[model samples]
Target: MKKTMLIIVLSVFALGCKPKQTVANTKLDNKTERLMKGDWLVSSVKYVGSDVFKVTSFNIADAKCFEESMWTLVSNNNTGEVVLNKANCATFESKITWYVNKDGNFVMKFLSEGIKAKHTTSGYVLKVANQTETSFQLIDKAAVGSNTAEIVFQFDKIGN
Candidate 1:
């Protein structure tokens, strides 16, 4: 009985002890520190339902359409921006919320630029049913009837 009681006490203590955070986790934190600043390109975007384009290929032709861009890395890889023109035109400068989902996914949101005009970007999450990739597809978060947008983002490492 005495030995059993001692084992129970030690077990309780062991259960209470928690592991320390390591240097690698710190590095990941640093990597995601900016989470929402810099330039990110769209690689693919799928609308929830009846959508027009998928943006499968990346190219200079697509770069021409960005006005501004931002990125986050906690999840798959979320990015948001405004497209003011096409064929390497110019991206409109606008502030948007870009991040991953609560369940470790990508997500994005675009605020209104005008009263009557629709916000062109929303949703910032990257993930599929059973696969994860280095890239993510931004699609409208709420299908139609929502002001939010869906977009695919390709991140260019800060130096590369």
Candidate 2:
């Protein structure tokens, strides 16, 4: 009878200790950090056409030169490295860092320009259009030669 009573009391205590809400509350910043932790691949690049309204998309697979390119994002310190896996392109890595700014836009900073010259000194400040466990979409408005265009970058998580 003593053992039974003790077990019943412990069970009641444990049950009461559990959080009232089944799902723990997660802050938006923390949630974004969690989702951003991974090795991502450039799935596609889309650009606004001459019409300035029409959009044209190009898949990485469609470009035979780029086969296994990947962007490894270090979640802890908002740092990362870009590897452009192509025979013609220089294999040397370029340092990269990224984070969500106060405005909620996703900003990427390149410490050094890679051999491929992915971005300019200004870097890229892109808005996160969508994000999920496996994929994310970033959009930016930038000058394309003589005209301003909308650039959409699509990335898919390849690894943790």
Candidate 3:
């Protein structure tokens, strides 16, 4: 009876102590990590309560002048970073910076210095959804006011 009770307690303790693991940690590789480091293509975009724009081709550059940085930005028209999407005509100079949060997810800042607004700050978590030699998708856990949404960007490696 004592042995049976001990076994039950052990099982309960073992279940409680189980470690959490993620699938991305297993499959992620060095090459994939490097591809993520550089600039790529911004293929699609959607704004909250705003119009939808499907980007056929736009450059995403790693703004290394600062660290913990990523940008899903379009060229500023006045700033002369112009990749037009028809004549609808709106370009963003968005910057996304990353740091590990207390929740163990990436904490990001989405900001822009652009023709529309100055010093705009947005927050998100960019999780690696999928990746390959030429392209990858990042799932942005974006938050605005009391609402939250996901944003994705598919990028192709430059000169690779």
Candidate 4:
């Protein structure tokens, strides 16, 4: 009888001590790291909504300045940087921090004024519509002045 009671207690203790699932187990933390750790080219940029309309499809070839521009993402520390070579538009580069939040949304944090004086502030959360090793799509719906705009950024792998 004593041996049977001891076995029962041991089983209960073992069940209570089971390991919990970590952020790594969710797969996003690891996947985000794997997919973003490289240099990407801005393949396409699109905007729509009250603030902006769907203009003609544009790519690096259409914009000469943009051709030299590149986006580098370092997933190990959730940091990123963008080099804006559009001198005709602006002459600025930006350092950014990024992460996948609890809600599974991608968040960007700017340490300074950033690439665009009007566009670069904290709390820009982008949704990952689609992603793969060769390509990635991020959508950001944000308020610009009194109007709202939906911006889509499509990137293609260029190098590591």
Candidate 5:
């Protein structure tokens, strides 16, 4: 009886630990990816919430610094680069891999020099909103004392 009970417990535990599977919305992903491939500029960064709330975007610099940053998205390989060259802020550039997930989440992983994106265990996810041929926004949420706030990155296409 004891051996049977132990076996049953282990079986249940194994089943419960199985990973969940999610279906990819390939149609949406492909469409968004195609639309996003090109040069873009971070035209503005806005915070929507209490005026006292402060947030750092992507753990890089203040949200304001992201304004005027240039982004190049190459859809063929899902690779890109971001160039932050705003005045009064440290200049920065990074290679990034990005994709649009099934749920319309924009997933991105920044690759440092000599580091492969697959080896990195973490990345950022933001909801894609108001996407168009000329403009789009990436909205990230932050916890603000039990309330949630939004950090919006507005991107405008730079050129053909």
Candidate 6:
């Protein structure tokens, strides 16, 4: 009877201590990442709501400056760069690390000069929409008064 109780207790403990199963990256995430690997240009920036609310994209500049910006997405290392080269806007380049999570959200962290991506604790999460071989959109939702509006960044593949 003692041996039987010991075995039962051990089994209960072992079962209680079982490791949690982590969610692995899905095939759709991999496919989306693959499709995002290329040179892209922000063809346009569309605001879907009231003009009174000014939205700053990526917390860096106004949404208008992002139009015509150049971006490079390297899938292998999940690292890329963005160049804000629109006329009358500040021309600068920023390194970014990005990946599509299991939930299909686009997670991106900007790395400043001399700063490593892993050390940065803050980043941006945006919903990816209208993805295609040659085009895609990054949708950022902002609260306008009591309504939620979307700032869409339309990207078009620049070159092969």
Per-residue lDDT tens digits for candidate 3, residues 1-160, read 9999999999999999999866422222334344445456555443335334222221332211112222332222111121323233443344444443233343345435542323434444456656676666665544455866555555555554
Quote model 4's TM-score. 0.59
For model 1, residues 1-160, the per-residue Cα lDDT tens digits are 9999999999999988967655311122223324434434443334444455433212222331431343433333333444443444443444444443334443345545552223453333443222223333333233334454344334332322
Per-residue lDDT of model 5, residues 1-160, tens digit only? 9999999999999999999999544444878888999999999888885557777888888888999999999988999999999999988899999998768888898899999998987888899999999999999998777888998999999978
Model 1 off-target regions past 4 Å?
1-37, 43-85, 88-93, 113-152, 158-160
Ranking by lDDT: 5, 6, 2, 4, 3, 1
Better of 1 and 5 by lDDT: 5
| Model 4 misplaced regions, further than 4 Å | 1-28, 48-68, 113-121, 143-149
Q: What is the C-alpha local distance difference test score of each model?
A: 0.40, 0.65, 0.43, 0.64, 0.89, 0.88
Error of 2 at 120 (Å): 13
Error of 3 at 122 (Å): 4.9
TM per candidate comes to 0.33, 0.58, 0.38, 0.59, 0.84, 0.79
Expressed as tens digits, the lDDT of each residue in 1-160 for candidate 2 is 9999999999999999988766422223556756878788877666656434433212122232333467787777877887666667445456777777545577666675443334434555667768898988777675556877777667898865
User: Which candidate tops TM-score?
Assistant: 5
TM-score of 5: 0.84
- The candidate that wins on lDDT is 5
Question: Which lDDT value does model 1 have at 56?
Answer: 25
User: Tens digit of lDDT per residue, candidate 6, span 10-98?
Assistant: 99999999999996443348788899999999999988755556777878888889999999999888999999989988787999999
Please provide the root mean square deviation of candidate 3 (C-alpha atoms, Å). Answer: 12.6
**Candidate RMSDs in order:** 12.8, 15.6, 12.6, 10.8, 3.3, 4.5
